[model samples]
Target: MQENEVITDRDNVLFEAGIKLGALYHQFTGSPVNLDTVDSLEKGIQESISVQPCVEKISVSINRDMISSKLNGKYGYCELEGRMLDVHITAIFKTAKVDVSLAFDTELDYPLMKIEKIY
Candidate 1:
């Protein structure tokens, strides 16, 4: 952004949504999780992100199959990873609201963060 250029509401909404997604991915990716605790983890992430400015709402879902496949026979948990998360967020800044998401893209073999819609 140029120093004197205007920042629109859509731009602010997208920026806030991006910050939320980045925070969610980086802050929780290495945390320990098991099938039994997945629900709490999801809710925890949602609640934490919801408190940020301009965040209208947020959703977080962790892949249970992925968790199950990686549950240890002894320890019985796996570290949360970007590939195991399916997340979406809506942020409103002034009159603009934007939808954004972070999810595993199987074809690309990566977790992709994208802007889904703007209005």
Candidate 2:
């Protein structure tokens, strides 16, 4: 195998993991809150990440915190209707390990959650 080929393969693994994480975030945001949402989300996220050819294992954790009051203008001022959540995703690939943290707010007009940040 050539040196460039090895590097390219590694890059591809990272790229694929990143894309899967983005898709997972999109799937979770703005989703309806229900008894089965958590279960479904976990299953979907795991399945999505694990499907990557380079992925070895994946772990997803979601933390939902209730907003006591409506967010004021200082805090990007959105109506407080749905929950705020922090999603942590870890993907272990054959050549790399990727950790993604996403902050989401689901109170906006759209059914999907608003992405606050990605770390």
Candidate 3:
């Protein structure tokens, strides 16, 4: 996908799922949280989900709102989900950044799979 391309319904659902899952996996696994892992994370996610024919393309976005909160030990996360594309973000005061993970299946409304957190 292009760097600035806007997400659309025509995009592959599995790819979308992989992007979201990859973001969550890296978010929870990183120390000091290197946002660069997003690329590697995306690659890993794509490889795992490539078996699914439904997936076509994938994209991801990260909110750097926490840039100033580093000194304060404050961490934040952003995630989008569902047809309405609800957004949720939370800030926490801790050594590690928070993570946001979500899982879905053929049906959009119900979460068939999920990661522990969404950061």
Candidate 4:
């Protein structure tokens, strides 16, 4: 593939991955962050990639990554805490330039309220 083509493909992958991660963040957080929010955030990120002047603007490659996630928060009625998930992602791309590595983290917890007085 031509260098430009490769760059395009890699950028697409990165953008998609960012969106996926944003969705996962909402899921893990038990929140309502949707496609609109993801799209908005991603646009800013992409723009930054293009506008920011930098040297050796090539690509990047990642591999053998291990992710360990832990969650701890108050659930109102009771404190809820535990390991939410763990993942290992292997990403590969061109190097020598500004390669944006997007990392996201989220904490999720559900709370139950107790009645103080009977009505």
Instruction: Name the candidate that leads on lDDT.
Output: 1
lDDT of candidate 4 over 1-119, digit per residue (tens): 64554455456445543443343334333322232243343344333333332311222111111111111133212111112222222222343211323232333332211111111
Residue by residue across 8-108, what tens digits does model 2's lDDT show?
44465556656765676656556544332555665666676677655555565444233323334465333222234444445454655655544443455
User: What lDDT tens digits, residue by residue, belong to model 1 across residues 3-99?
Assistant: 8879888888888899999999999999999988999999998898889999887889999999999988999899999999999898999999998
- TM-scores, all models, native as reference: 0.93, 0.46, 0.26, 0.27
Candidates 2 and 3: which is better by TM-score?
A: 2
Model 3 misplaced regions, further than 4 Å: 1-32, 64-119
Clashing pairs in 1: none
Displacement of residue 93 (Cα, Å) in model 1 is 0.3
Each prediction's Cα lDDT score? 0.92, 0.49, 0.36, 0.29
Give the Å error, residue 20, model 4: 1.0
Which candidate would rank higher by lDDT, 1 or 4? 1
Score candidate 3 by TM-score against the native.
0.26
TM-score of 4: 0.27
**lDDT (0-100) at residue 79 of candidate 4?**
12
